[model samples]
Target chain A: MEIRIGHLYPDLLNLYGDRGNIQCMVKRCQWRGIEASVTEYQLEDPIDFSGLDIILLGGGSDREQAIVCEKLKTIREDFKAYVEDMGVVLAVCGGYQLLGHYYDTDQGRIEGLSLADLYTEQGSPRLISNIIIENEDFEMPFVGFENHGGRTYTGDLKPLGKVLFGCGNNGKDKKEGILYRNIVGTYLHGPLLPKNPHLCDYLLKNALMRKYGQAELSPLEDREEKEANLYIRKRFLERQ
Target chain B: MKVRRLMAVWTAKIISAACRLSGRQGVTLAGKIALKIDPGILRDLSSQVREKIFVVCGTNGKTTTNNLLCSAVESEGKKVICNHTGSNMLSGVAAAFVLSAGISGRLDADYACIEIDEASTLRIFPHFKPDYMILTNLFRDQLDRYGEIDLTMKILSQAMAMAPEMKLILNGDDALSAYLAMESKNDFVTYGITEQVFHDQDSREIREGRFCKKCGAKLEYEFYHYSQLGRYRCPSCGFERPPIEYDAKNISMEHGLSFEVEGRSFHADYRGFYNIYNILAAYAGAREAGFALSRFSQVLESFNPQNGRMEQFSIDGTKIILNLAKNPAGFNQNISAVMEDPSEKDLIIVINDNAQDGTDISWLWDVDFERFLDPSVKSVTVSGIRCQDMRLRMKYVDIPSTLVEDVEKAIKDRIQHGCGNLYVLVNYTALYSTRNILAGMQER
Candidate 1:
C-alpha cells in the first residue's frame, strides 16, 4: 500500500528544521515496505487534497508566515473539506497558529484558516524551552521543543495533551495543542515526530486506516527513538 | 564621571586576573561586571582608538573574520585590540575594550577590530560606531534567541540607522547581506567569487534568502556555491548581485586554499570553502581602511586556527582535527570539509542543548548526515548532552553509530583502537571543554 503526503509551502513555512517531519514519515513508511511519496505544494500550485493521505504544514518566519497566510486563504474551502473528511494533518508552531481563527500580533491581526475553534494573541517574552506532554491516546509521553510568541486558546476543541513540562498553549491553562478529528496542531517543533515515534506512527496509522481500511503496522526497532524520548522525559519529568 | 570609569576598569581587571588564577576563562564575566559599574565604559574606551575601528557581524565566520582582520592590521605595524576568545556579545565587546585599556582607564591602540553579535547590535551601536562593518553572511541560527531572519534584519537595520557614517563591507554572494547593504544606503564594498566551486547536490539545505527582500520576488540563481551563496539575480525587480570589488578568482581547494583577489595571489591552510569568504572579508576591510598589503600573505600564512576552529592535534602517530559547528549550514560545511579527505577515518559528533548551543536540537535533522554513509567513514560515535538525539538522527540515515555519553571517552576510544585519522565535530558550549580534554590526552 502507498500513502501520499502533501507538504504545504515548503519554501516559505520551513523554520527550525521543519522538513524533518516529512523525512521521518517517509522513512518509517519505506522501512515497513510501504511506499510513501510526497508532493510539495508551493505558493501558487494547485493543491488537490483528495489525492493526499497526510498533509503537513510547518512553521516559518513572520514575513514568510504572512505570505503563506495570503496564499492559504484562497484554498480555505478545499482545506476545510479535507479536514472534515478526517484527513490526517499535522501543523506546528506558526502553522499551528495559522489553523485557528486569528493571530493578534504587535503589527496587527492576521486571519487564520478558521477550520478549528481556536485563537492566538501575541505575548511578551516568547515561551521557549524543551517541552513534554502526556496524551491519553498514546502509551508513552511525547517530547519536543517549543518556541513561540503567540498564546493560543482552543475555545471548543480538545487539547492534544497536558503540559508535563515547559509552557504550553497560554502557559496558564496547563493544556497543549488542539486535536480535532485526526488533525493535530501544536507549538512543538523538534520536528515533533522523529523522537516521538508513537505519535508519528499514530498519524501514519490514521492515514493508513483511512485509505486501506486496516492498519496492522509491524513495529520497527524504536530503540534510538525511545532512548532519545526517555532522555528528555527523564530529565524534565524527574526534575518535577 | 572619569572616576567612575576608572573604578569600573580597575575592578574588571582585578576580576579578570582572579578568574585566570582560578583557571576560568572569564570571557564575558569581566565585561558584564564592568558594564554594571560604568554603563558608559564601552563608549569611553572605544573612542580612544588612535586609528579606525572595524566591527564584524554575521551568523557565522564572525570570530574568524574579526581575528583575521586584527592580524592583518597588526601586520601593518599597528597595535590592535580584539576579542580573541570568540565572545561577540555586548558584554564581550565591552570587555575587549576594557581589558585592553591601561589601569588609568585609557586605550592606546592604533586599531580596534571586534566581532559583534548581530542581535546585540542595537545595544552595542549606542556606545560607539565602527568605521567599517564587515558582514560575512547571514543564515538561520538560534531561532529561539533571535526570532527569525527577518527580525534579525530589522534589528540590524535599526542599528545601521543609528550609525549613518559607518561603511559596510558585505559578502556579495549572500543576497541577504547584500540587500541589507543596499537598504542602509551606506557606502558599501562587496567581496565574492564569480565562479561556481561547491557542486553540492543536497536539496535539503534551508536557504533563508531565496526571495528578494526588495520586491518580494523569487531569486534566480545561475549556480549555488553552497546554501544560497552564489550568482543570483531577481528577474522581476532587476535587483542582482552587486559588482564585486574584491573578486576571488583562480580558486583551488587542493592542499588548503589558493585564490586571487584583484590580481594579488593569496593562500591559507584553511579546510572549508567558507574560509575563503572570511579571508576575503578581512582582506577587503584592511584594504578599505587604507592599510598596506605587502605583509598580507605572510599574515595569512602565519595565522593559526585556535579555539576549535579547525585546530589540529597529533596523538601517538594518530592525527585528529577539531572544529566547531553550531548550526545546520555550518555543520553541513564542516561535513563537506571532512569528506574532502579520502583516508579512512573515525568521526565523533558532540551535540549539546545548552542555552549557548541553542536549546532546540531540531537543526540536527537539517544537516545532511547521510553523506557520512561513505565507506571512508569507517565508524561514527555520538557524544555530549544531546548524544541520544544525534544518534537517532544518524540512525534515520541508516548509518550505524556507537553511543558514547562522555566526549573525552569517545575520543580516547577512537584514538586507541580505530584508524589513525579522527575528526571531532562539536557545538558552541562543547568546543572549549572538548579541546581541553584533547589537550590533556595529548600531553599524557
Candidate 2:
C-alpha cells in the first residue's frame, strides 16, 4: 500500500537541514518495499490534506515559524476535520509546536490551532541541545535536537514522551511529545524513526492497517519479530 | 538553576574536548553550548581578562576580514586571541575567552580579534563592546535562520546602538553598512569600491530590500556590486554612500588590478578586485587596531583564502579550484570570478538540502548564473541533493551545461577526462564532502 506523507513548509520550516529527515524517511520506506512519497507545501500554495496518510513538519527560526503559523491559521478548520479526525502527524521541533495550541512568540506573529494541550511562550530562553525522550507506554527511546525558546507544559493531555537522557526541556518534568490515536506530534527531529524502529514500525503498520487491514500485514509476521529484537537492543543501548 | 547552567557549560567542555582529542572540530562544540548557557557569558568572561576586544562582522567578507585583521594585528608580534575555527557565535567567543584568557581574566594577547555571527552580534555587541567593530556588507544569507535583509538590519542596528564609542570600519558599497555608518554616533571609517565588474548596473535578478528603510521610498540601484549592494541612491531622500575615508578606484577583472583609496593605490597579489569592499574594510579595521597602513596593505595583498575559501588544486591535467558561495552575493562573486578568467574552464557547483546549508533551495533563483554566459566557460556540472534544482536553473539560464548529476560521479567523470582548470563552487555543507570525494577519486 502507498503511504503518502505531507512535508509541510519544505521551504520555511527547514532550518538546520531538516529536509534530511524527510529524505531519510522516504529512503528507508523505499528500502522496505513501502511506497512513500513526500508532498511539499510552500507559502500560499493550495494543498488538499483530505487523502494524505501522514504529515511531517520541521523546525525553523522564530520568524519563519511565525509566517508558517499565520499561513496555516487560515486552514485551521481543514486541519481539525481531516488531520485531527484521521491522518497521522509526525511533527518535530518547531513543527510539533505548530501542530498544537498557540505559539506566542514575543518578537513576531503567534497562535496555532489547539489540537493538542501544549502552550508555548517565547521571550524567556531557547532550549538548544540534543535530547533523549523516554516513552513509558512505548518501548523505545526517541532522539532529536531541539532549538526553541519557550517552555511547553501540557494542561490535560498525556505527554508524547518522558525525558531519558539530557534535558527534555524547560523543567525535569520529562515530557517531550503528544501522541493521540494515529497522530504523533513530538519534539523528536526527522530521522526520528532511525533510532526508534518500533515507532517507525508502529507508524507503518497503522498506516497499512488503516488502508489494507490486518490481512495485508500478515506478510510481515516473521520479519517484524526479527527487526523488533534488533531495534530493542539498539534503542536500549542509545538510552544507556 | 545554577546547577543546570554549570552542567551545560561542563557538557560543552566535554563535547569540545572529545571532539578535539579525536582530531575533529576543536572548540566549536564547546562554543555552541556556551552561548546556550548565556549569550552574555562570553563577554562577561572576557572582562575577567583585561584586554581590548576587536570584532570583524559582515555577510560575505567576515572570514576574509577576520583573516586579514589577524595577520596585520599579529605583525606587531602580539599574542592575539581569536576563534580561527570560524565559530563566531557567543559560545565560540566564550570558549575562546575561556581558553585564551588568564586566571585573572587577562587575555594572553595584547588585543582580541574575533569574527562575529550576524544574529548573535546584536546580543554579543553590548557586552563585548569591541574597541573596533569592522562592519561588513550585509547580504541576504541563510533565510531560514537570519530572516530577511531588513530583519538582520534591525538586529545590527540594535548592536550599533549599544556600542557607540566602538570604532566602525564600514563597507561603503553596501547600502545597509553605508546607512549604518552614516547614522552611527561613534567614530567611523568607510571603505568601498569605485566602478568595477558588471555590478548590478543593468540587470534583472531579485535585489532584496529595494525600498528605503528610512523614508519608505523606492530605493534605486545604479549598479549592484552584489545583491542589494552597490551604488544606490534614495529617490526621495538624498541619502547616498557618505564619502569614504578610503576607496578603491580602478576596479577591473583584467590582469594587474588595482584600486585607489585615500590618495593611495592598493594592489592585490590575488584576484581580489571584486571583493575590494572586503579588502578595504579589513584594511581600515586593521589600521584602526593600531596596525600601520604599510603593514595593513602588505598583509592584505599577500593573504588569500587559505581556509578553503578560494583554494586551487590540480589532479590529472585538471586544475580543480574550489570557492565558497553560500549566499546570493557570494554566489555572484564566485561565479563572476570564474567568468573573469579568459581561458576556457570546466565548472562544478554542488548544492545540498541540509539544515546547515538552508534547506530552502529557492535561494538558487537569485544567484546570477547568467553572468557565466561568457565564452571562457566550456563545460558545467551541477551536483548534490539539489542538483536537479540547479540543473533546472541552468536549463532556464542562457548558459549550456554538459553534465548535471550527483556530486561523486559528475566530479570524477570530469576529473578523469582531463579537463583544463575545473572550478567547483560548493556551499558550506557540501564543501567538505565534495573535497573528500574528489580526494578519494584522486587516490584511486
Candidate 3:
C-alpha cells in the first residue's frame, strides 16, 4: 500500500526531533514493503488533504511559533475540515498547542485553528520530564519525553491516555493528550514514534484503514524498538 | 569592605584547599561559597582590572576562545586570570576573581579573560563589566536550559546595553551573532572566514537561523561553512552579514587549518572549521586588547583543545579518540571530522541525561546520524543514561541492535575483538567519568 504523509510547517514549527516521527513512519512502512512518500508543507504553502494519508505537525521555538500561528490561521478551515473527516493527524508539543482554540502565552494569546475543542495557557514553572502513559489501545504503555510550559485543557474529547508517570496534558489532570476521532495530539516528543513502535504501527494501521477500509499490517521484527521502549518506561516507572 | 572581601577570598581558598585535600574537584564550589560570603566580590575585583577584563560568551567555542585569548595575552608577557575549566556561570566568574584576589584585596593580574554562559549574560554584566566581549557564535543549545536563540539574543542585548562601553567582537559569518550587532549599538568589531572552508553535506540538515532575523523572509545563503555560519543575507529588509574586520583567508583544514590574518599566516593547533572560528575570535579579541598582531603566533602554535575535547588515547595498540559533543551541531561536526578518515572505525556515542546535560534526550533525534552509515563505519555502540534512546534513533536509520551495545561492556568487547580505530563521542555530564574509565583502561 502507498502512504502519503503531509509534514506541516516543515520550516517554522520544527523542533525537539519532530522529524523523527516522519522517519519512524516511513521506515516502519518501508520495512513492511509499503511505499511512503513525504511532502513538506511550509508556511504559506497550500495544503491539499485529498491525497494525504497521514499528517504530522511538530513544535518550534517561541519566535518561530508566532510566525507559524499567523500562517496556521490561514489554513485553519482546511485543517479543521481534515480533522472532522477523521483524517489521520498527529500534532506534537507546539503543534498540539496550535491545534487547540488558543494558546495563551506570556507575551499574548495566539489564536489556534480550534480544530479540537481544546486550549492551552502558559504558567510559571514548565512541566518537563520522561512521561509514561497507560492507554488501552496498545499492549504496552506509551513512553516519551515532554517539555512544555502551556497546560492544555481537553474539551469534549477523550484523552489519549492516562498518565502513569510525568505531567501529561496538564499537571493536575492525570490525563495525557487529546484524541478526537483519528486525530492524536500530545506533548510527548521522544519524537513519539521511534521508541513506541506499537503507537507507530497503530497510527499506520489507522491511516491504512481510513484510506483503504482494511489494514492487516504484517508486523516486522520489533526487538530493538521493544527493548528501547521498555528501557525508558521502566526507568521512569522505577523512579516513581 | 576590605574585611568582607578578605573573608570571601579566605573562604574560597580554604574550600579550594579542602577540596584538593579530599581528592575532589571543587572548581565551582569555591566560587559558589565565595558568592554566598560576599556577593560584591566580583564587582570589587573586576573594578580593579577594569578595561583589562575580557568576557567571552557563545553557544559553542567560548571555552576554546577564552583559553586561546588568555594564552595569547599571557604569551605577550601579561599575567592573566581566567576560568580554564568549563564553569562559565556567575559563581564561576566570581570565584575566578575571589581566587585571584590576594590578602591585600588586590588581583595580581594584568588582564582577566572570563567565559560567560550566554544565559547568564544579563546577570554577569551588572556585576563584572568587561571592556571587551567576544561572541563566538550562537546556536540553539540545551533548549530547556536556555529557552531559545531569540531569548538568548534578548539577554545578550540587555547585557550589551548594560555595558555600553564594552567593545563587542562578533562572528559576522553567523547570522545569529551578526543579528546581535543589529540589536545593540556598541563598538562592534566583526570577524569571519572570508574564504570557502571544508564543505560537509551534513550541515544542510542542521541549518538554524534560516529565517531573516530582521524580516520573516527566508535567508539566502551564498554557501554554508556549517549550520548557517556562512555568507548569508536577507533579500527583504536588506539585513546582511557585516563586513569582516579580522578576516581569515587562505584556509585549509585537511589535518589542521592554516589561515592568513592581517597579512600574517597562522596555524591553529586543533582541527575543525569551528576551531578555526574560535582561533579567529581570539585573534580579534587579543588585537582589540592592544596586543600586537604578530605576537599571536606562539600562542596559536601552542594552543590545544583543553580537557577531553579531541583528546586521543592508545590502549594495547588500539587507538581511541575522545571528543566532547554537547549539542547536535557539535556532534555533527565531530561526525564529519571522524568520517574524513577512510580507515575502518567503530563509534561509541555516550549520551548522559544529567542536569548539566539537559535531561531531555530528545535532541538526539535532531542529529544527522544517518550520514555515518557508510561502509567505513564498522559498528555503532551506545551508552550512558539515555543509551537506548540513542540506539532507537540509530535503529530508525536501519542500524541493527547487534551493532549497538552497552558502554562499559562494548569497550572491552570491541578491544577484545581487535577493533583498532575507535572514536568515542561523549556529551556533557558524562565527559569526565567516561574519560576516567578510558584512562583506567589505557593504564591497564
Kindly report which residue stretches of model 3 are placed more than 4 angstroms away from their true locations once superposed.
Answer: B1-4, B21-23, B102-105, B198-204, B401-418, B439-444
Residue-level lDDT tens digits of model 2 in B1-444: 445445555666677779867756657667677567656556555664445678888777787777767777777676677776566776677777655644343345677878888788876766667788888877668664654455677787788778888888887777777777777677887877656556336444445545565664557766776566677789889877677677777665466356676667766655544467667776777666665666655665577565556766667778787777898768877876776677887888888757777654556655667677776777788777666546545644545565455777887788776357888898877876676666655666
Task: Give a tens-digit lDDT track for model 2, residues A17-91.
Answer: 354455445644665687888787866578787777777777665666666787887878887776556567777
Question: DockQ of each candidate's interface versus the true one?
Answer: 0.80, 0.03, 0.73
Displacement of residue A135 (Cα, Å) in model 3 is 1.2
Go through the candidates in order and give each one's C-alpha lDDT. 0.90, 0.67, 0.83
Q: Please provide TM-scores, in order, for all candidate models, with all chains considered together.
A: 0.97, 0.61, 0.95
| Tens digits of per-residue lDDT for model 1, B4-109 | 9998899889999998787677869999999999999899899999989899999889988888898999999999999988888999999999999898889999
Model 1 DockQ reads 0.80
In candidate 3, clashing pairs total 0
Model 1 stretches with alpha carbons more than 4 Å out = B1-6
* Tens digit per residue, CA lDDT, model 3, B1-444: 778878889989889889868756576899898888888888878887734889999888888889889999888888899998778888888888888888777887889999998888888888867889999888767877765667788889889988888999999999988888777878899999877765544433756789998888989877788877889889988999999999998887766778888999987656566887888899999998788956677777777676667777888777988888988888877887788677898888888888888877777877888888898899888888777788788888777534344566767766767469988889987787777778889988
lDDT of 3 at A199: 85
Q: Against the true structure, whose DockQ is highest?
A: 1
